[model samples]
Target: MFKGNFIQNLPKIYGTYTGGFLAFIILMAIAENAGVSKETIGILFVAFTVCIYAIIGYLSRTVQVDAYYVAGRQVPTVFNGMATAADWMSGASFVAMAGGIYFGGYTYMAFLIGWTGGYVLVSSLLAPYLRKFGCYTVPDFIGTRYGGNLARFCAVVVLALASFTYVTAQINATGTIASRALQIPFELGVWVGLVSILLCSMLGGMRAVTWTQVAQYIVLIIAYLIPVFWISSSGNYGIFPHLMLGDEVAKLGELEATFGLKENSKEAMAAMTFADGSPVKGLKYIVNSHAGVPDGAMAAWKFISLVICMMVGTASLPHILMRYFTTPSVKAARKSVAWSLFFIALLYTSAPMLATVSKLSLMDPSLATGIIGKSIAEVQSIDWYQAWNAQKWMHIQDFDNDGKLALNEFFMRGDIVVLATPEIAGLPYVISGLVAAGGMAAAMSTADGLILAIANALSHDIYFKIIDPKADVRKRLLVARALLVVIGAAGAFVASMKLTSILGAVAWAFDFAMSGLFFPLVLGVWWKRATRQGAIAGMIAGLGSGTIYLYMVKFAENANENIILGIDHLRFGIIGASVCFVVMVVVSLMTPEPDKATQDMIDEVRVPSGKTVLGKQH
Candidate 1:
């Protein structure tokens, strides 16, 4: 028993997917009685997963050094796109966004658009230039640009805050998916996942996490796509990626005869208390849109915020920028971004369609009512509500004072979309197990990367770079390992709290990066006259504006009616980005640019090797 417990604590490290695959085995055993077919597709998915991890680990041995931090600066544009796809498609994509789309209607597309388009901005505006700088972290760029240690220190703080917040949130998302899909305790789910992240991250730094991400990318995309295939094929139209409501409608009409749909689920109503002291009014929703959700996909300002966060945040992210360093040249960096985007688009474009189709099916009367519903219930009774009741999550309330279940309340959560897919489309039990493991993979991939980044920044950027430049690389790496332990422990504690609003936390992180660094980096590269004063002022304004707004939304106990304005954390980041850009321009106009050496460096970053730029090249 002791050995088993210890081994579980330190997940086996063999294949590239050691942690995730083992967890997959554990999930399969638990799901053995989930009433799924438990055959062919499951074996195929598991085999694909193992191969993915092996390929990544085998190749990553070639990835070493500070250059590896930037992906050797040799990564082709296409691979970079694939890598970036892996980077951005974290736990959020694996679970949350699709669910949000299902629940929020077309409005959720605004978030997707923002996330996807942001990469375009990053690749075009910032990623290539930063790659040329040969910097290890975001603060490295700031330190050199400002010629001030203070600026570098500040960047570290913001980076730590933004990243840890995002990491913790991803773990929470993993727990949410596991709890719903496997009926596991949320805290146990988080701990089981976090251990995997710690092992890989603590081993090879960014090198380990990068390879792991590649493995996770395959699993995540597979888990997502397979279910869509099942659902589409199960429908009548034979239209792939297209929904046919014919079967669903017929099914629903029958269910309505008994266990009728309540006007609005009481569970959903209980979740809201409006300004007028009345419950938010709306009909109950089964798959995605529950009562009291934002009426549209997104508002205009919200849209703007999403774009800025996704685009700017990706470009400046320390770990992502770290990948470019692994590439061999500026051209490679450019090419890599293209590949990452292509791979990412595979699932991103499909997400909305999947959400829409999923909502239609889950809410179909036949499935939600009599016989089919009874079958779903029988399948669900294995571990039963007894295990779930202790978790105190997934409430089922009777609305209209009726004795029957509301069922609609489950749809409102953002992670439920993927968790319900295998079961809903009538796929095998192994798919459910695979998805649960996949969720862990997504969470671990991001969590370990973030943790390692925090550790590396402390040892490499601060202790070694600034405080003690003479420190040996090995010792520096050791220091980094120590920090990883701290970060992992902290993230686990935060995840165990069962904190909701992961999407909100992620937005705050993007805002922090955008508000504080976007303008400084943007102007530093483009404007020869961008002085230290301008960068400082712009950063302050951007970060300050965003921070105040976040406090109002997340912390303030009693808030104003402006809450109805729909300005979330993402919107706040955009406002802050604007302020920073304006302040930088105004200050630059009042002062002179960096000296000739700095200006020359800027010119150098813009020109790719073997290409002549008129009289440029410093």
Candidate 2:
């Protein structure tokens, strides 16, 4: 089945992805209807999905340097796009994105717009030209462009920092899925996920990662669509929930109005709290807040700042930029970006709908009407609430000392919304298992891409280029595989700490990538006067400033003072990026222009069609 040209083999791979999943669903339905427990079914679903990815990874393994680094540069556009989309939508995109929207409301539009728009920037400014330039890693582009080892090293440091931060979050997400699916402790689940991540990535590098991501994309798209459609159908929102969910959003607004749940009010703020005697304090209700809707200049400034950060960050991510290197040619790279955006939009557009449908379901009159007047015990009798509470995934307190329940009295974690949707809608256990599999697919696919990005930067850029230029391909491959293990272990360790919010970690990583690399990368390709000195200076300033800003926000007592122009520290990447752009332009003007060779190299990539030079550098 794998013994043909990529075009010829494409259908078979797609068939395997779709057909294998259908078979799993059929078998799971039989087992579930035949009296299998939910836990057993969930375990089977996750195991089955992982097994499929593992098989793909194992079969696609390659020791050849080209295959190891960039999948032989033979991936067709459509398949490459699918792989890129899968890589782009990580664990945060899968599990926490909708939850973020459900909790933060209109403010969260930054994620949707920034992420999607970032791809437009990719196709326009980065993807095709990078393919034409023909580099193994993002740092290779930087080092070669600037003609210095220092540029390369700085690029590697920034890339590793951002990618490692992002990968830890993906690993953390894997643990979250595993713990919920297997009903195991979170720490044990982290190890299970770490082992599975290694199994998928260790053998093949980019070759394994590319094909496995395609399969993962298939699983995740199906997994995401199923529950939303099921809930939509059951709720009479029609079969196409993505198009029909506005009505549900309207219904949610009505319910909020009826319950008098004003998000910005002191009453609403007062309602938020952790479980009684819960070590965590200052946790307020607004589990779903409609607070501080973006209304004026401050809102616009904050929104635009976050959007810019996300857009630049998305375009700057090394793992994502590496995807274009796998495509067959420059034209293929451009075409692949279009397909990538289309595939990603499938989920991005649905996310808001999912958030709305979930909120509507939670506030459905039938399930929630009597709860407002009932005792905590009586509310516990409700199956959905009881099931979620029993798992300790959610906690509801009788805040306000009222014996009866109110909208603010019921506080559940946002993480539980998508995972518990199957039960909330009274769907069968099979669907629940399927959702777990989907979440795992999302996490594993992104983890595979991120780990490869880090491993390649170490082995190819740092080791092969600088440490041991005389090293053979075999030695280089060995180093890469070793780094994969080391990096994966390190990321898993940080993930086990679970210190930051999942989405917060991802956001910070994006901020770091954009701030440090965005100007140096974009200017290197498009601006001829950009010099090594300028690139180096800009990167240090940007990275140093962004890192300092993030540290202050995370650890300093006067963190609030760090907010500039009323923008939060999380959006400070916009400031960092702006600083870098200015520094690069000014420093380049003060320094000598790039050599003629460098200018010609930049011109070579500008051609729409060119040979993609192979090996470590163009």
Candidate 3:
């Protein structure tokens, strides 16, 4: 059957999340004696993993390097969509995005809106054209398009900057999931994940990752949907009777209001500012719980920077762009994106439901309780406002000994929801283990792909092209494998730090890609006048501007407006992207365009006079 499917058989994919996932099962058999939640975790440990090599082996015995890197560039449209969805919806999408909406209000929906909406641009404007080039990676496209090694080198720099920055965060997410699911040290969990990715992906390359990701997509979505379905069924079973997400959204809203805020949470969602009622700017005025955290105090640039990263991020992402190459045809490439969005919607819709419901759960004192502030007895009832602070991983602080939690006292972890869901939902330990496995799936799948992409660039783009043009395939693979280990270790080192949220780390990488490279790449592809000088200049300016802008937004908050074109990230991205485009155009007007040879190649990529070409050979 579909041995490529990991969820259908977990033992196969065990090495992907770490052999620890398999080790988790043997330990689960002894869990009762060990005082760990056993059966549920054991079922999940078994059910979610697969004997991946066995399944893949059974699926296809003989394979070529082409299949490893690009699934032989002939994956079916629907399957490619599912696999890409899995790749696109990495750990950041699975874990941090919803909690983002939770704390950020409606603003965070931009993740879905940006990523989803951006696909329209991808499929219509970029993906099919890129596929027409018949390249294995983004750098390959750049190298072949301009027929210049310098162009390829620039693309490599931009892609590496965007992808590797996120590699650590994904590894960190894997480790966190492991710590919760298996009760291991956070650092050890990361090591296990790193080893798993290095083993499965380095040896197999894209050939292994594509099949594994397809299987994982199935596993990840099922694992996610089961818990969500359970929550929905427990609340209102009728909605699951073949209804779609919109109707389900209405049902969820009703369920949330069906139970009022726990008495303690009456103070939630305070206003952002008060212009009419505030007469005193001094301490003599009375402050009510209803009064919100005033403006001019909150971190606005953080919000701006995050949105900038996301809006500009997806188009340039290496793993994401590479998936387009796997489609059986350029037409398949376009069709797969629609499918990718459809599959992605499955979880994205549920994510908001989970966040809203979790918010409700946190507010319900009965489920969340034991203590509030300094007194366990103080708010003996449910209070959404007060309980919101309980959601904080950092802890609540009360200054001046008043025993009241100020708005600033509350600090929450983005990953906390995914990790803490076991205790929060009152689910068994097994479910927690399953969730951990899910996060690991997201992390390792992405990590493996990223590490492979990095290795390919170094070995093929730099080494084979420059150092030894006559390098054999075997030697190239050897060099690629060696490079994988180096990059994997670097990723592991960063993941072990475990400081930022997976979403935040991923977002940072996206900002670099979106702002620095999207403009240059897009213009280089379609614009007739895009000279190499223009392309190089745009890349430098886009990359430099985006980088400096991010540091300003992150570090020198006081000068955010002064430093960054004084706009929101969404708006600023438009500005930064435009800056790249305009600079490229202006520079190109002053210089000669690439020779007619380059122009002819551009025309070939742009004007497809016939159906998409598709095939594979070994």
Candidate 4:
């Protein structure tokens, strides 16, 4: 009865929590107006939010294996949907997505379309079936379905590599937010963020991560929407920014022409100069073309290829698939996907508005923006410029030996767009702190799910399934907690090295998952003839080909020359996935059919209303 009431009251419970959170924000706004220091507000936002997540984790901590691994498979549909959306909206989505749209223009909409379309594929192809399978991890399904330790081991390898790469991007985003909010070194900020992430997932695992992520989604969506609405309401773009996006884009194009910021234009690519008249080394600022593509000849191919990779990769991601396993029923899993898409759409639809307004804040010719065409010293005197410059995230220089700033002379990292938009638009300091908190929530929420996915794969699939099948619940939970700390620390270390931009790293991770896991997982469910040997061969072939292509494009000299048939680093997954599908089909056809029991298992998974196939056996 208690459980039933709690499940029934979920809407009211989360509704009240949302109201309280908004009230807290109002109180902070009051404090800000009352002469509170910006530093104090920033610190308070981060400290307060992290404490709340930690407390949720402590309350949700469990000794039972089922609770730790699958949240006891009793999560209601709506809350599970919220958790999945928070898990999906990583730092890349919250912090860098708008930046992508700002710089790359409509060409970057591939991410938006591809990611959202991926959910449609999830609901149809993967989510319901996976939930009915009753597995704890992706590897468990591969191992069980294919009837071998080797197939499962391969799945675990892919899950860890892809997840670790993705998690580093999340940690990097956290570091970016923490460094700005707390005024600390990026290296130190990575560790600080890691500690907070650990507190949210280490004890309670998926159980803790689910509830904490729900809270995070609330904070993040509110944080994301407020600034856009604030900017719109201030008479910049009118009351509905989304409706005004077309007009704003037209305005932006005119401004680009006035500033000579066209794609690949000579003026846009001119060398920059420091205030001392020395050349700024290795810098170029290219604005999006009117069509939002760098090269018109290959735009369609690149766009389609990217969309396919993102969609396939979305279906194959192990952490996302794990979310379905926590739903109460297969019906709930399907509903959860619908809800996840709705929640994700809220932020995604607003991103273009934020991107346009942010660009306008700097480039609007009618405004009193003294920075453009102004002397270097004069631009340096701007408060927002000085603040971002001190953080080393923005740079300005004169390339023409002119005493003024050019539109092309200014440069900022794309990762900072969402975080810096509040200040760039002349919003209050409290809004900036709110944006910082939102960015932290986005990064930390995804990090918790990702780190748990990796640790769970290792502890449950590798340590228990393969190494010690007799391991008790307590020991398994202990291993999972310890692995979470180690894997998280490694992610922080890699993040500190700053291998690439947050979006770039995330794309690479998606490609890796697509290359290695997509065909194997998909065919395993849809085709009963898929043998262990075929699955293993396909995983190796696809991942191996994708990795080699990525290495050549990223590390080889004259990397541009290595791009074959216009497939760049981001689109390599198309080739990889195609190769995997063909290889798996051919190999499966050549091998003997699976035994009767295995075929029956596949038949059972197709039916939606049966008891979980492996729920009690293990």
lDDT of each: 0.62, 0.83, 0.63, 0.85
| Residue range with the least summed lDDT across 10 consecutive positions in model 1 | 609-618
Quote each prediction's TM-score.
0.78, 0.95, 0.78, 0.95
Error of 1 at 375 (Å): 15
Which ten residues in a row are the worst by lDDT in model 4? Answer: 277-286
Give Cα distance to truth, residue 235, candidate 3, Å.
Answer: 3.0
lDDT string, candidate 4, 177-284, tens digits: 888788899899999999999999988999999989999999999999999999877745778888866777788787777788734445444544444555543332
- Cα distance off (Å), candidate 3, residue 239: 3.5
Report how far residue 114 has shifted in candidate 3, in Å: 1.6
Collision pairs in model 2: 272-284, 272-285
TM-score of 1: 0.78
Look at candidate 4 and give me any clashing residue pairs.
Answer: none
The residue-by-residue lDDT of candidate 1 on 1-618, one tens digit each, is 235542132223333244555565556655576643444335444344534554554445432445224333444454445445666667887777777776565455667777777667667877777767767667777777666766677667767877887888876765555455444577886775565566555555666566567667666776677677766666542466644544543444454343344455455566654333454432224432322234455555565556756777766566566566556567677777777777878888777656655665654544441222333344235342333323332333333344334444332345656775666566656766577656666666677667766776776668876888776656666676788888888887898985647777776777787778777877777777888777777777777877887777667876454353566645667667878899888987898768887777678767776432211111
Off by over 4 Å in 4: 1-5, 262-286, 290-297, 369-378, 402-404
lDDT at 320 for candidate 1?
Answer: 62
Q: Evaluated with lDDT, which candidate comes out highest?
A: 4
* Error of model 4, residue 198, in angstroms: 0.9
